[model samples]
Target: MNKFRDKLSTRNTAETGVRYEWYALQRCAATYYREFEKPKIIWGNLATRASFTYDEKDHFFINAPACMLPTSSKFILGVLNSNLISYFLKSICAERQGGFIEQKPVYISQVPIKKPTLSEEEKIIKLVNKILLLNKRINEIGDKKTSESARIEQEINKNDEQIDEIVYNLYGLNKKEIAIIKDSLMK
Candidate 1:
C-alpha cells in the first residue's frame, strides 16, 4: 500500500494509471492526518442497514465518514451500536432493495446522540470496556469450542443484553416503546 500512497497525491496515478480524482481521496488523507490529534469514530456507510459497525482505530476513512468527536470515547460507539439506534435508523433511513437502507453521511449526521449523565456515562464506559474485552477474547479463541470459550460467549451475550437495556433507558423508552422497537427490528 505504501507504493500506492502517492497515487492519490494527485488526481491520477502516473505509474498505475489509476485515477482517484473523482473521489475525495486526498481530502480523506488530510483528515486522517488531522484526526491523530483528536481521534474520531469510524463506521461503515451501511451501518444502520446492518449492525452498527464501528471501529476506534486511528486510520483514514476512505469511502466512510468519521465522526469527529471532541473525545475519543468508545462509549459513543456503544450507544451507536445499541438496538435502539438501529431501530431509529431504520425508521429514518430510506429503504433500498433487499430491505437495506443507506446509512449515508446525511442520515448519520442527523442521528440524535443523547448526552448521558455523569453516572450513566461511567456505567456505559465500563460496560463497553467489558464488551470490547469479551470480543477480543472471542477473537483470540477463534473457532475452538473449549468450555472456557463457551462460558465467555455466554458472558458476552449477557453483557450485550445489559447494554441494550441501558441504551433503551438512556433514551427514556418505556416498555411499550421498547417492545415496538424489538418488533420492528424482528421484521
Candidate 2:
C-alpha cells in the first residue's frame, strides 16, 4: 500500500478534474473500471481494452480511474468489452497524437448508454458472469494444464462471442453492420 501511496501527486487529474481525496468517499469504493491507451487504435486492435478487476485492498485506483455504476458491474463490463461500444467510442472520442483514443472521463462520459430492458439486462449479466468465471479459472490455472483448462478456455471464447452478439442486439446492429465491425476489428 505504501508503494501505491508514494506515487500520489499533489495535482488533480486533468481528465477527471477531481482531487484524489474524492475517491476516499465511501460511495466510490465499489468501483470497477478500465483504461484505453489511444483512440485511433482501440477499435482496430481490440474490441475492448479494459481491466478485469480492481485491487479492493487499496480501495482506489491510481493512473487508471474506476467507473462506478448503480447497476451490475457485469452488465457494464459486458458493454465495455463489446465491439459495438468500441465502434461507438471511436465515432465520438477524441484521437490522441499517438493515433490512440483518449478514454478520459470527458470522452467516456459521452458514450451513449442504452437503457436495457430487464430481460436484456439479465442476458448480458448472465454472459458476463460466465465470462468472469472462466477468466477466474484460467487465471487460477498456473502450470497445471488439464483438459479442464482447455474447457475453461473454450467457455471463455464462447461467452465472449455471446457477449458480442448481445451487444449487437442491444445496439440493433444488423448482420452487415456487425460484419463491418468484424472487418474493422480484424485490421
Candidate 3:
C-alpha cells in the first residue's frame, strides 16, 4: 500500500510548468483580493531566473505597465500572497504536468484588501497618467545623459591629442616612445 501511494504521489507530481503555476496563482490572488471591501491587495510572482520563450499567439502581451515591478521581485511577492492550500493544489497540478515542485511551498497569506472606492478609481486613472509622464521623463533624461557623456568623451580625446603633440615636440621622443606613452596613459 505504501509503495502504491508513493507511486501515485510521484505520478501526480510530474504534471505543470512554473509558468502555468504562476499564472494560476496570479489569477486566484487577484480574484480573491479584488473582492475585499477595504484596500485591494495585489500579489505577484517572482521573476524567473531562466528565460523561457513563448509563442506570441499563445499568450496576451501588453507593453508591461510602467508601474509593474521587475520579474525577479514579483515572484517573491507571489510566494508571499499565496495561500498554503492554493499552493499545494498548484503543486499537484504542476507535478501532474511534469513540472518540479518547490522544495518548500512559498506563498503569501491574508494580505489586507485595498479596493479603491469609486473616487479612488478615478485617482488611480490619474496615477496611471502620471506613470506615463514619468516614463517619458525617464526617456528624456536617459537621452540627455548619453549626449553629455559623448560630448565629454570627445573633449577628452581632443585634449589627449593636444597633450601628445606637445610632449613629442618638447622631448623629441621616437614613434615607439609616443605609442608606448599613449598606450600606458590610456590603460
Put down candidate 1 lDDT per residue, 69-137, tens digits, no spaces: 434677787787778888878988887778777776677677788889887788877887887788889
TM-scores of the models, in the given order? 0.71, 0.61, 0.23
Q: Which candidate do you rate higher for TM-score, 1 or 2?
A: 1
lDDT of each: 0.70, 0.61, 0.34
For model 2 the local lDDT of residue 3 reads 54
Candidate with more favorable, higher TM-score: 2 or 3: 2
Q: Would you list the rank order by TM-score, best first? A: 1, 2, 3
What is residue 118's positional error in candidate 1, in angstroms?
A: 1.2
Clashing pairs in 1: none
lDDT of 3 by residue, 1-187 (tens): 5545544444322333112332122333333322333322132232211111112122232333111222322222222222322333343322312333222223222222234345534443443334334444555667566665565556544543443343354345678766664454332
Model 2 local distance difference test score: 0.61
Q: How would you encode candidate 2's per-residue C-alpha lDDT over 1-187 as one tens digit per residue?
A: 4455634543335645555653252323222233222111121222133323312222333434443332335677777768876676767666655445656556556767687888888898898778767777788996688899989888877887888898788889999999998887665
lDDT of 2 at 72: 35
Give the count of colliding residue pairs in each prediction. 0, 6, 28
